[model samples]
Target chain A: MKSNNSFRYFLIFAGAGIYQWAFWHETPGLNISIFTAFIVPTLLFLYPESVKKVPFWLVLTGLLSASLAIVVHASLFATIMYVISIILFVGFAHWSQTKSPVFAIPSSIANLVLTPYTFFAFKNYVATNNKKSSVFLKWVKLFVLPVVILIVFFTIFYNASDKFAEYSDKVLFPIQDFIYNLFGNITFASIFFFVHGILLITWILIRNKNTNLSDAEKNQTVNITRNKVRRKRHFQFLGLKREYLSAFILLVLINLLVLAANIVDIVFIWFGFEFKEGMNLKQFVHEGTYLLILSILLSMGILLYIFRKNQNFYSKGKILKVLSFAWIFQNLILAISVGVRNYHYMEYYGLAYKRVGVCIFLILVFFGLITFFIKIMQKKSSYFLLKFNSWAMYLLLIISSLFSWDTIITKYNIKHCKELDYEFLVHMSTKALPFVDINKLSTDLSYKNPWIINSNYNYDYFYVFSMRNYYVKQVFNFLYDWETDKFLSWSYYDKLAYQNFMSNPELVKSYKIYKDYRIKKNQIENGNKNSVQNRTPALHSDESR
Target chain B: METKIQFKTELLHYILMNPVRSEQSGRVVFSEQFAIILKIITS
Candidate 1:
C-alpha cells in the first residue's frame, strides 16, 4: 500500500514536471498540451485497474480526434472538436470507475469543480498520519536550518576581511550568475500552473480511489424490502378526449400554414423569382433563417409536451401523432427552404463564416426533426431522445472540426469567384493569408486605382507594427512574464505568415517606392498651398506674369 | 386549468426541483471552507 501511494505521488510529480516544460517550450502546439493533460489523469487515477472497456476505447478515440484537430490549424472546427473530446474524456473517465454511465456528466463536472478541495483534504489527511511524509518534513527542516546557518556564517566571515571577501566573490560569481538566471526566469504564474497540474492529478487519483472503494462496499451490502403501495391521485386531465381532438385540429391548422409558406418559398426562391423594389438578398436570407430555426425548435417542444408519459395512451393519440409528424415534415421542408435562401445569398455576396454556420445549423435542425419523428413513431421516452440527440450533436461537432474552414473559404473565393474581396482577404487570420494571391491583386489594383496602393501600404504598416508590438511588448509586460509564458502566448502561425509576407522582396520594394512617392507629392502640394495662402499682391502679380 | 396555467405551473415545478441526498455526511465541502481549513493547517 505504501509503495502504491509512493508511486502515485511520483506520477503526479512527473505530470507536473511535464506541464511546466510544455508551458515554457510552446513548440508542439495545443495537441501535446491537451494529450498530456488527459493522459496524465487517466494513467494516474482511472487506468487499467478501474477503467471499463467501452469508455476506455471511447476516450482513446477522442484523444486521437483532438490530435488530428490540432494538426489542422486550430481553427473554430478544431476548437469544437477539442471541446467535444474534453466532454467525452470526462464522461468516459466517470463511467470507467463507476461502471454506470448515468452520473457521467455530473460526476465529470464535480471532478473538475472540486479538484482544489480534494487536493487540500488529501494533503491534510496524509500530513497528519503518513510516516513517510512526516519523515520528509523533518528532513527538510533539518536541511534548511543548516543551510541558513552556513550562509550567515559565510557572510560574516566575508564582511570581516576584504581578502576573504574578494576570494569568495571570485569563487562564487559564476554560480551566483547561474542561480540568478535560473530563478529570474521562474515566475508566479508558472509556479501556479505547476501547482495546478499537480493538484489535478492528485485529485483524480484520490477521488477515483475513494469512489471505487465506496462503490465496492455498497455492492457488498444488499438490502431486501417489500415494495410499498402508493395512492393513485385522480388525474382530471387524462380523460379529456375533447382536448386531444382540439389539439389535433390546431396541429393540422399550423401544418397547413407552414405548408403554404413552404409552397411560396418553392415558387419564389427555387424557381428564381425576381426581387421586388427593396427586397435584397441579405434581407431575404437573414430574416427567414432564424425564424425557421426557432419554429422548428418550438414545434419539437410542443410535440414532446403533447406526447409525454402516459399521455401517449390517449384514445385520440393516433390522430395527434399523425398531425405532429406532418408538422415535423413541414418543418424539415422549411429548413431546406432556409438553406436554399442561404445558398443564394452566398452566391450573391460570397461565402462567409456566418453563412457556413447557418448551413451547419440547418443540417442539425433537420436531424433533430428526424429524431423527433422517430421518438413519436417508436413511443420512446424523453431520456431516449435526449441521449440520441446528444450523441448526434457530438458526432456532428467532431466532423465539423476536422475541416479547416478559413483555408476553405480563402481557396474557394480566390479560385471560383470572379472578383475577390481583397480587403476581407487581407483581414483574414494567418492561416488564410498564404492562399491569397497578393501579387495579382497588387497589379490589378495598381492599374485600375493607384490610390488603393497607398491605402494598402498604410494598412500593411499599421498591421505589422501593431502585431509586433502586441506579441513583443504588451504580452510580456504582465506580472508573470516568464520566457515560457511569452512563448506559449505567441502565435507561431502569425509569425510564419509575417515571414511569408516579408519573403517577397519585390512587393516590399514596390511598397516602399509608393510610400516615398506619396510623401514627395504631399510635400510639394503642401508647399504650393502654403505659398498661395501667404502670398502678397506683388508676389501674386509676378506669379501671374 | 387552462393550458397556459398548466404550462406555467409545470415549468415552475421543474425549476423548483432539487436533488435529495441520503447521506449528508458524504456531501463535498464548499471551496471557501476548504480553503480556510488549508490556511489553518499551513499556518
Candidate 2:
C-alpha cells in the first residue's frame, strides 16, 4: 500500500507534465484529442480498477467526442462534450455500483463538486503520517506551498498586466533566472499549466469516501412509494384524494386553455398561413419562440408539481394522467408550431444564429416533453427525468458539433434569400468567409435596395455596398490564416474553406475592383461632405493575401 | 418517346418585381425568398 502511494504520487506528477505538453499555449485542436487519449492510459495506471471498468458505451462516447476535437478543432460544443464524457467516463466507472452503472448522473456531479475541496489530499497525507516531522519536512511545508502559490499568482499577474509585468520582472528577475536555470527551458505559460495540472490530477485521483454521491444515488428508487391503506382522518391533508381533486381541476382548466391555443395554431399557422407585406415574420418567430419556451418550461414544472408522490399513485389518477398526457401532447404541437414559424421566417428572411439556435432548443424541448410523458406513466421521480434528459442533452451537443453551423447559415442565406443580411454575414465565423460568394452581391434581385423605399434607415445602404472591399479584405485574411495555421490548429472546416477559396479566387478579387469603383463613384457623388470616406484606406489585397 | 423540361418563371418574376420591406431595424431586409421558398409540410 505504501509503495502504491509512492507510485500514485509519481503518476500524478507525470500526468501534470503530460498535461502541460499537450495544452501549452494552444487553443483546442489535435492537442485535446492527444491529451484525452493519453489520459485513458495514465488514469488506468493510477486507477486500474476504475479505468478498466469504464463501460464500453461511455468509452465510445469519450472517443467520439475526442474525435470531433481532432476533426474540427473543438468548437464550444465539442470541447464541452469531450470534457464531460471523460470526467463521467472515469467518475462513473470508479464510483458507481454494478447495478447502477447509470450512476453517471450523481458521480459526474460529485466529481465536479467534490474534487476541488480535495486539492490538499497530499498535504493531509503528509501531515497525518508524519507525527514527528523531520527538520527538512518542516522547512518544506512552511515555504513550498506559499512559494508555489506565489509563483502561480506572479505568472498570471505578469501575463494579465503589462505595467505590473515590467516592474515585477525587474524585481523578480534573479529568482526567475534561477528557476530558468533549474528548469533548463520553460515559459510562464508552461509554469502556469504545470502548477494547475498538479491540482487537477489531485482533484481527479483523490477519493473522498465520506462525501461520495453515488452511494446515495444508488439507493434512490425511481418509483415513488404507495400506501395500500389510507391515513387517519386527522392526516387527510396529506392524503391523495384532496391532492387528486385539485390537480384534476387544474389540469382540466389548463388543458382547455392550451387546446384552444393549439387549435388556433393548427388552423392558421399550421394549415394555411401567408407572409403578407406588413406582417412581422421576425416578430412572429423571435418573440413567439421566447414566449413559447417559457410557457413550455412552466408546463413541465406544473406537471411535475401536480403528479408529486401520492398523487401519482392516486386510485382515481386515470383522469389526471389523461389530462397530463393531453397537456404534453399540446406542448409538443406548440413546439412544432414554433419550429414551423421559424421555418417560414428562415424561408423568407434566411438563416441567422438565433434561428439556428431555436432549432437546437426545439430538439431539446422535444426530448423534455417525451421524458415528462415517461415520468408520469412510470411514477418516476424528477431525478429520472433529469438523468435521462441530461444524457440526451449531452448527446445532442455532440451531434450539433458535427456540423459547421456558421458556414451552413452563410450558404443557405446567400442562396435562399435575395437581399443578403450583411449583419449576419459580417459577424460570421472565419470558416464562413469562403462560403460568402462575393459574386452574389450582384444577385440582389431588386437591383435597387428595398430599404431605399422605406427610407427609415440607420447606416446608408450604399455605404454598406462600398464596404465590399472590407469584406474582401476579411476573406483574404481568412484564406491567408488557413494557409499559415499549423496542423495543430487545423480543422476539417479549414480544409473545406481552403478548397472553396481556391475554387473562387478570381471571383472574390472582382468584388474588390467593383467595390473600389463604387467607393470612388460614391465619394464623387458626396463631393465635399464625405471627404474622410473619399480617402480610401489603402486596401492592398495582395498584402492581406 | 419524347420528354420536355419546363421551368416556371413565376418565382423569377416575383423576385424581379416585389421585395418585402424588413420589419425590425436590426433584422434582414425581407426579399423575394418567400416566393422562392418551396415549403413542404410533414406531420
Isolated chain B TM-score per model: 0.32, 0.28
Clashing pairs in 1: A77-A401
lDDT of 2 by residue, A464-508 (tens): 332233344455545544443445556777677667766754544
Q: How much does candidate 1 score in TM-score?
A: 0.64
| lDDT for each residue of candidate 1 in A206-241, tens digit (9 for 90 to 100) | 443223222432342212222245547776454447
User: RMSD (Cα, Å) of candidate 1?
Assistant: 20.7
For each candidate, report its DockQ versus the true two-chain complex: 0.01, 0.02
Q: Tell me the spans in candidate 1 whose CA falls farther than 4 Å from its real position.
A: A1-10, A24-41, A49-51, A97-103, A123-182, A195-242, A273-278, A439-503, A507-545, B1-43
| Steric overlap count per candidate | 1, 0
Error of 1 at A16 (Å): 3.5
Q: How would the docking of model 1 be graded?
A: incorrect
